[model samples]
Target: RTLTGHESVQPQTSREMLSSGHWLIPTIGGDVWLERPPPPMWWIGIVYTVTGVKASDSIARLAAVLAALPIILLTVGIAKRLFGKGVAVMAGLILATMHEFYSYAINPEADIFLCLIVTAVLALFVSMEFPHVRTTGAVAGSGKPSFFGTRPWPMAGFFLLLGATNWAKGLLFGTVMAAAPIVLYLLGRALQERSFHPLRPYLWCWGWLIAGAAALAWPVAVIGQYPEILQLWQEHYLGRLHRGYLREPWWYYAVQVPYVLLPWTLPALVGLLCSARAAWQHAGRERFICCWALSAPLLLSLADGKHHHYLLHCLGGWAILAAVGLAPLWGWLQDKLRLIPYSAALGAVAMALLAGTGGILWYSRIPGRWGTIVGAVVFISLATWVILTACQQHHLLRAFVGILAPILAAYWLWVPYQASYLDDYKEDLVFLRGAESLIPNDVPVLVQYDWTAPLETFWVLYHMRRPGVLIRDPWQAAEKTANGGQNSSTAYVLARRLDLPLYRRAGTVETVLESTRTRGEKNPDQRRVLYRIHFTQPLPPAPEDYLRVVRRTLW
Candidate 1:
């Protein structure tokens, strides 16, 4: 926890932590956001407090890790029930092996938590439809067909949490809205056919949870200052949705699926192909699982405005399906080692893969000898581990684990170096940090054309701990320097990319370096949003073409 100036702790990817700092604190002056939205995620803060690792990068990312734990548990539960414990373990491993899931679960982003909560809701609701009272591998209440089987509470609470997740991120709320109602309604029809009163309990519990969670989460600032909160929500969440400035082609999620999901997609897709209507017939829960795996991706694909992260929830459904899909293979193995010859053939193929992968690394002329060697070691070790486990009395669980272990290990080694992929956002962070050291505390930071929230979060987190004037607009920034008799003239800003040449008249606009860590990616070629600058004097009036209409640039 060393700080160059302010007493600050350095966490894993110090720059990324700083980028996210805005979520925790308020430092931007005169901004009208609510003082603090009742932190729906205060538990994250609690985790840091209890573990004393809050100051560490791990603490910042704890929420994601915690969220992923449930998916693992539920996969096991579903696998054990639908197939066997062996399949259940295999399913969980397949999920953990996916680079996308691991990346999200290892970061501070809210997607992993979204994944966890959504998984919980699905598991609980499915369990309620098929209670444990019937342990004979039959979907409980198939003949009776009740939604409210034995456990309704889990489903009830998840609805509340689902809403709370919306409060955390608007996209997740949208996911729930799109998916949950249809699922519930279909389950309700099944319950009706079985002559059971399931819908009432389902509605009562879920309805109360949603309302109660909202009341608990209603921003205190909104109660005390309504206008400010509304405006903030409008500008921040709803406005962004309306504007859709970050819009991507409809196929973006579909395109990213292979890279994001990696090794798991192969097996999971195979699982979907193998799913049996005969096995799942009359099984409402199994039907829902199938629906979940396929529908979420289709919905995301159809979305007009989409982002890569929206599909986090879809991965869990895949894991469970893959587990179920692998169940048959696992079952066949349990009876005999008769499949050994076939598996050994596959093992030989996998060995060739391992050797070829090692050779590629050795020849790539990669920097860092240790990391490269470590990667090669991981690849071979995992392939061998999988082959050995496969050769054992077949545990579908072990089979999946055997295959997945190496992939996960390879990922554990590769992704960190690949983090340069987020170079788009990193350039600005680097520029800001370099500027921070040279620029005086009194200098007003005139932000460029865009709101580089990531860069803004960094400066705010660092500068808030040491209060100073950091203005955003050129006009307002000039005013701070206008009264130079009483106060020292503050440095303003200009963009190198905009190339207005205003800085030449004003004096100087020095460049700063800003680089943030991108998860498991190498430095990328993308442009950063904000470029840090230190102006020696007020920005000259905008060119005649633009200055006339710049009435409210200061705000």
Candidate 2:
């Protein structure tokens, strides 16, 4: 799939960095774009350099996948440290198969990278502080705890990642997301233990100085170059805390939790309930995992800004909790089904798998999809036979295999199919390519668009390989292209057909290139036109516009 929406930002900025040879500051359309920190761009740049391949969308997305692999391993390690090995395996599977996590794994966005770093930081903190927590039937830890509850290496790694969170997202957002949970867990521990011992590790860790230094490095360097960026940074970071940006209701995240968790929603809720009960009785790993899981969503809910992707940071904790809830349920199924015959259970499972496969094949009877249908059928049949053969020794094994096999198959088959099918929804890149061929490389292009709809402009800048400037107001474009203006030499404006009248009012507009394409399944008549504007006279100040009002209202 082509990069669309904000996903284009990653490769666009990386290309700029490589072309301009300015790694410290990232640029988009030849303008410094400090809205996002430079780590994801740096990762993409590194991938381009190491592979010696042209920077394509696929290669850029590969960087995100590489970053996500560590998150899965870290989730497994964290679960193993808190629960037993059984729960660890289950937790890793749940996280890896989750729809949101899988979507972001290949997406060229900073959220997945942020999630990786945050998970690492919390995992190290758990290993350090709760190294010897007692589980249901076993104790989980590497060995006896060393000084400060961990050795020097892990302590240094924890502080380093904790500070590196700033680079993942920004100076304030990542640090707050990581630290809030630690503070909550420590407060809970202090209340339960009736001592200040839980706070000792934080006080003694002077490696925080290293973390602080690392976090401040980029901000200080960028601010030194452009002091005005300090104000922009404040508006971008601190402004989200109030009711000005992406404001949703207080219970927004609560409503989204079930959808995000998908198949594990009920199990995660049960696990959360069990952990809450356990924490009420004692201070242990349950409390720590609970804090890790709930802290970010709770804190983000309090703030006005909310988006579904922000919940990625909390997925690790929820996956572990789902495992915690699923382990006993597996045992319960074994005990409850002892009276049922083994042949009867296997027959029932086989019948259900056949029915599901038959229904899918019936529904997806397209001419070209027959290959995929046959493959899915054969895969399901083999998987069912293998499960039945392997679990003949024990009913408990049969029950576990029965529950997990379908999920694995869906992750391998259905997810990819859905992604491929949805790739046809947005045709921005197709139209932008058509428009790109019409405009010369030497001519400057100004993308006239509303502030809210910058995705197409970003697409032009990235795919067209031109220094495109986004102008929210038509007057801005006229001012730039007016006689004796800075950009008066052969400038063109790319805008939608609906917005052509507004641009015409600002100047004498000539249609250079007009293209029409379906935006998505719902909006099939989308049209875009490139216009060469010749400013005849200076336009007076315009009245208040609806787009400007909406932009101000939101920002």
Candidate 3:
């Protein structure tokens, strides 16, 4: 709900709205969100159109979250098919309770949806049979659900979803996420059958995949609507693979694994260790899950631009492996219920409660401390009871009971508090709403920023519900605000503290509003001031601004 919670869009939520808004506009003259492909945004726009609800950040994000439900179901199906009913249950529960999954669910981005599609692809890939070389296509009693007399319908589904995934993000992500597992499965099949001819089914599957991809409307619509899209894709998206904006070291995704998959990272690693042997043995279920999980991130790490959301596609593999690791423990507990002490388990839960409560109280300065503590205590107490009950029952549930407390605590306790603390734009939204009358609708608003932060653009345009532009520097804005009697347009410029001195030196800047964003990881407390800088008398443009623009145009 974070995406839709604010009347004005929040930081990352703004980016979502901007892209989706472009989709809603008519394709003829509409602007496109060029950072990536437009499938996610276009789909969201379709949702808004069908529902007749005002297309807002919340609605767009809700669409993605709803689409994400299948990721869990598909994971369960794949796990049940590969491992067993017990492993499937544990895998589903782990995925359902995961912090990474929950965080992305609320985030109005394509990552979760991509995860869903990728998981579906893996599920289908895992369901196929690698028969001996002689019987590649015409197997009578194979017991597999064949769609095209080539491979199972799930294989076809993989190709269709891969097409959608590509449209949502880009070709590279879709290709790697889909192709790696298929290649690995084929290799494993060939190794197992002792013949290269076993790969014939996969070759036929590729033809089906190509046909399914061609049938998708996104490809036709995108090419028909935006002819220059190829150029934009190259300059904006593909360029990032080698050297473009948001470049990071090769080890970037490697470092992010712990943070992105927090609270589950340890279990996931343990799961990988436990399943390694089975995965290496044959082209069976275990091997498929392992290859599916490891391949995407390894391939993604090769790219120069790394973001946290890209790793979400691997959630299926990670969750299944973790379940593999936890499955033996569950079996052991079931077999020997008398080995563990409930008293010790309860004590650990109590310590966790105290640590959680004490940390929030010590660090949180916001109101509602009492409510947060009470909530934590109650949740922890409930979790402790669950552990005790599961221990008594001697079931697979006890496996979840151990980790459920902390995971739920993060969901119930820390996330709400973090959201409250991280509301850096709350005051600005309120202020904008209150003083809406002071700002005229006709006066164009321009945000002066060196980097792209769609949050500012979203809030300003959303609050004003008017035309706005994000330009590189204050000087560009200063020139835009100039009124030479014949052509006059007053511009509102929002700038951070570092850029404030430049605005001050440039014109008679009247302060509109000032807001401060709290400090957090990798960022200091930042102050931003908005100015109603009218160029009734425009200042001379800086010479460096001209040179910069010339260099950019030339480049």
Candidate 4:
């Protein structure tokens, strides 16, 4: 709402490129950087070119949302090819509802696009049936898909998608996608046949050609034009992947998976275990899906850099697995609750019991023993009644509602409240826009805070149309801007409330605007206070402000 649909706000990854107006060759701070490919930027650039419109969050995010469509279709097709139509629909539904997948579906980045490409690769991998069923249709895969001898077209398609994924983001996920299918096919074959077969000659030639061509296509073109970018690529890969940049604990995703998958976590877990069991018994499509799902995470866990979106490509596996359980669970629910009778009386009784449980939990002051008894009785009765009543209908729709009720409730209830703090960027952007009249457009607006939001910076520069810059220190800002130009005496500074004292100690400052915002989940006592202070002069030479000067040494 803050910016028009035509104007897009980019994430930090895209911010540097957007600011530098560099699309063909990626750069950071005006230097050549090829950590990410130019495919996404090129795509966005095409949107701008065709529409004759400027960048906006709407257009940038539209790319991601558009990428999601093919992913969903590919997922359904893959699931249908392997499991059948029912599982396909369930897989689509599971993916559509997943919080993590949908989150990136709206993000203005290449992550979701990469996810789409990787998923397409996996779908193609699943499409090519085993040699025993080479002439079979989608639903007739012979439980033993050989990666080496897959149909020529599907193998070509797999390589194409893998290449697209590499160009869409980086090679991290692309490498994983390319290797995963081959490894899974080999492993699945070994598990089922108890022997390894030699690579078929015709298939091996085509595979090698596709692999070599797809892997080198973009890099050859890029490096041929700009050889310096290759060094940046090597440094980035070595530093970030090997040395560690955004490294988290090895178990980071282990903890995050529960939150990421949300309501589907339990079902996915059940399905994963089932797939494992099925793989153990006889390696088949389930084993392939299981392998695809686990590959990226296992590789990523071994790597130093970790981000949640990196797991987006793997979510399709989780969704398909989760979908595998939905039909069986629904069937069991129908069979179990068919005789229970879904009546209004039963629902009312359940609701009343739940209400009583809530009341007891809230106000039951029965000291110790009586309170425990009351709590247990109320809780148990409520649980039993609700389960019975929910299952009474025995229909798929009712079962779905029962299964997803908590998640739906949380989305409808808790999300608005959580978003109040989580999406503080909107308010901050609006605040900056409102203060536009008070602050001069020409004077640089220094955002001095420890934690910064890239969206806010995008909003400030693009939406607010002001000279927005972020500095680590207010004193350093004062030092640089002081007597630097005509508007030097009136530059604006947005700092947290805690940092305001530091600014005051360093120089003369005037508060133009101030507002309090929730800091985050942690730091309840602290807040993200936006203090729009106007620095009048440079700071005096002093020891306390020496740290600020020292920080500027990098500049």
lDDT tens digits by residue: candidate 1, 1-555: 112111111121232223345443222332322322324245455566577643444465565577677778876675565555666777787777776777676655445655665676666555655565324223323243233343345654656655554544433354453345345445645564574444444445445556456534555434464444545555555533555646667677667765666766655666776764632554444555566665665665554556666666767667767666665655555455464555555655677576666656675565555555555655565566465456364454456656665676677656565554322334444555555565556554444332333233333333233333444345545565565333444443423333334434444444453334321223432222233333455356655644454332221
> Given candidate 1, what's the lDDT at residue 295?
61
C-alpha lDDT (0 to 100) for residue 77 of candidate 1: 76
Question: On a 0 to 100 scale, what is the lDDT of residue 97 in model 2?
Answer: 76
The per-residue C-alpha lDDT of model 4 at residue 300 equals 77
User: For model 3, how does the per-residue alpha-carbon lDDT over 195-290 read when each residue is reduced to its tens digit?
Assistant: 656565555556565745643455556667556556666775566688756788878877887676666777688788887887776556667677
lDDT score of residue 377 within candidate 1: 52
TM-score of the candidate numbered 2? 0.79
Candidate 1 lDDT at 222 equals: 44
RMSD of each: 7.3, 5.6, 6.0, 7.6
Better of 3 and 4 by TM-score: 3
lDDT, each prediction: 0.51, 0.72, 0.59, 0.61
- Please give each candidate's TM-score: 0.67, 0.79, 0.75, 0.68
lDDT winner between candidates 2 and 3: 2
**Residue-level lDDT for 524 in candidate 2:** 27
How far does residue 406 in candidate 1 sit from its true spot (Å)?
Answer: 2.0
Q: For model 1, what is the alpha-carbon lDDT of residue 150?
A: 38
Model 1 CA RMSD to the hidden true structure, in angstroms = 7.3
Which ranges in model 2 have alpha carbons more than 4 Å from their true place?
132-153, 334-402, 424-426, 441-446, 465-489, 505-507, 518-526, 534-555
lDDT of 2 at 58: 81
**Most TM-score-accurate candidate:** 2
lDDT ranking of the models? 2, 4, 3, 1
Tens digits of lDDT, candidate 4, 391-481: 5555755656664554455456444544453444565555556566666656665655343332333344444454456555666676656
Looking at candidate 3, the ten consecutive residues that score lowest on lDDT are 24-33
lDDT of 1 at 145: 26
